[model samples]
Target: MRAVLFAFALLLAPSAPVLAQALPYHIDPGAREIVPSLAAVPSIRFLTTADFPPFNFRDDKGELVGFNVDLARALCADLAITCTVQAWPWDQAARALEDRQGDALIAGLALTPQNGALFDFSQIYLMLPGRFVTPVAAASGFEPASLDGKRVAVRRGSTHAEFIRRYLPTAGLIQFDSEIMALDALSKGEADAYFGDAMRASFWLNEHVGCCEFAGEPYFRPDLFGDGLAVAVPAGADAVRQVIDYGLARLKRSGAYDELYLRWFPVSFY
Candidate 1:
């Protein structure tokens, strides 16, 4: 009875605003997307791993939960179809998908050439943009050009470090062994700013309160950062791919995506 009441309440609640200004993902508001019929898709099996937190993982309750888990349910709900999500070990997920054990994989699988050959991918819904974090005092006058002669901390030998070497060549680059150490340098005022993956940095910002804040806009260089997160479907599953993409677009349009985004990512790295 309690479960039924809660479910009924959800049906009555309005979804979040469509294309909220703070949302990181964007879908064109003017475009008329004809969502394909999902009558043919009676149900879906979404495979993921119980490791990548906030994306997919077992919660303290030992239930499979995360942004991807909720998103998969949202996809099915949008189409009014049945769906089940299963968590597998990282090593065995690809093999299980290849064996037809699941219809889709939403485990942040990289859209690589090798994976592309093995599976079709839905449209990218999330991007791991690079960002800068500076001590609050230094954040006000921050600019990419002003980074020249500034001490910027980055993880040693990382792609982010390489990005700074190529683009912000004039900045004095200081490399640390890990993101924690780099952020620590910024907190200690040893570095003017820290540059690295925004999502990862957001976690740090959440934990270390009042020490630093994000500066400058997020940077998306897919060529350097690699392609962003997308759903992986079985190879030759064009119908499945279309349906997944359509559901994603619909979520963005209806503001359900915004609701989920805000719930999972409180810091709003973008």
Candidate 2:
């Protein structure tokens, strides 16, 4: 059955790109058929971390909830799939998908090459800038290049860690399990500054970390951050991957993607 479905998917794949570009609202015929089977496959789990709020986080009731969760649910609904959301430790989520413990990663993961080699990414659904956040007193006087010998906190296995390790090799790097913890380290003066996705950094600084403020202009590295966040599938899951990409294109053209983005983010971008 899987082979037959996959073969059908291949037959439909040739027209996907053209359809994605021409029609504002289109769904791959092949994907529509496979959608029903998704529910029966208990192996088709969605992986995410429980601590990353506003993106993917656990609510007070211990139910997984947030932007990524909602997006994942919506995507599954569009695909007519029953997707089970599971909380994997942050560092293990991607690995879980790679090992086939899960089918997809809906964690709003940035598309870095190192990751790209292991997984296929859906179309970029959201874009976020990276920023430097420091104590208010230190914000005005800080410079990215000046952190030569200072300690900087970044979430473990994050793009921030990738950036700092590559760009600020001379600086001390402290890897934390969560952004909240990294901010806490900064507040306690254990680290000179913390860096992360600008929107998340701003949200955290405004609501929780009052001691720090964002410094430096926001910039995104295509090499390190890629275009934006996407759902990642294990490499070679072409049929499932094509379905997701097609669904994403449909969502974008039909304005469903915009509506969802506005519902959660509100800020508009052309």
Candidate 3:
């Protein structure tokens, strides 16, 4: 499929030069810190699912590699603690954590109320916001408010579609079955702009090169888009959560987080 190939291409692409100036920092380096009052963490067991490429997946060499795996290593290094990241089927990952087989879940698990009952989540590290992409020529002039009669492409029944229905009601809504379909419509000029997950849009923009570019500010309605990605630790694991948060903040302060972001996402979404 075109989307799959695009993702593979993105993974193979050389790491781009650091875009920290343009990229937004998810964690504030200068924020007041609450030193976790806990015994030393000698080791950590991080559980993840491999099906989610770019986050956690097996490489052609059959070795575990991806942003999440690398991030786990970085976190461990930051704390000077030993850690093991293990992959399991998507369905089994949460259960493994529930069974005390892992210390934390690093995969992008949805932070829903149901899951909240079973786990405590770390501060969000990444948000998948909605963004608009238009033909390069139209990108400069594109404005969310000015799209009186313009067509906007989005995946049918997706949160992005609902966002358009509620917020940008004036624009004509064009729905597709998938993000790729919506992007394809935009590429052919069948739609004036395409609005969808910013991360996915970034990949398409990267693969298509000059076909299109991002326009306007990104929309981050967490209530509609779902809570951002966070590490999930078992219930009552406040100490573990605090430790992860400390490590994450340190990563942000040290610029290691930005380096990993650029290496994994050569095309900056923000």
**TM-scores of the candidates in the order shown:** 0.88, 0.54, 0.91
What local lDDT score does residue 269 receive in model 3, on the 0 to 100 scale?
Answer: 81
Q: Which of the predicted structures, 1 or 3, would earn the higher lDDT when compared with the native?
A: 3
For residues 193-237, write the lDDT of model 3, one tens digit per residue: 999888887777777888998898888889998778899999998
* Backbone-clash count (model 2): 0
Give the distance in Å from residue 81's predicted Cα in candidate 1 to where it truly belongs.
1.1
lDDT of 2 by residue, 153-266 (tens): 998998889899888999899999877788789888999989876655644554543587777766667666557677899998876676676667656656676566545443
- lDDT (Cα) of model 1: 0.80
Q: Which stretches of candidate 2 lie over 4 Å from their true place?
A: 1-44, 130-198, 201-220, 224-226, 268-270
Give the per-residue lDDT digits (tens) of candidate 1, residues 190-267: 998899988777767766768898888888889988688899999998777778888888888887987887676656
lDDT of 2: 0.68
Better of 2 and 3 by TM-score: 3
Rank the candidate models, highest lDDT first. Answer: 3, 1, 2
Q: What is the C-alpha RMSD of each candidate to the true structure, in Å?
A: 7.4, 12.8, 2.6
Overall lDDT per candidate, in order of appearance = 0.80, 0.68, 0.83
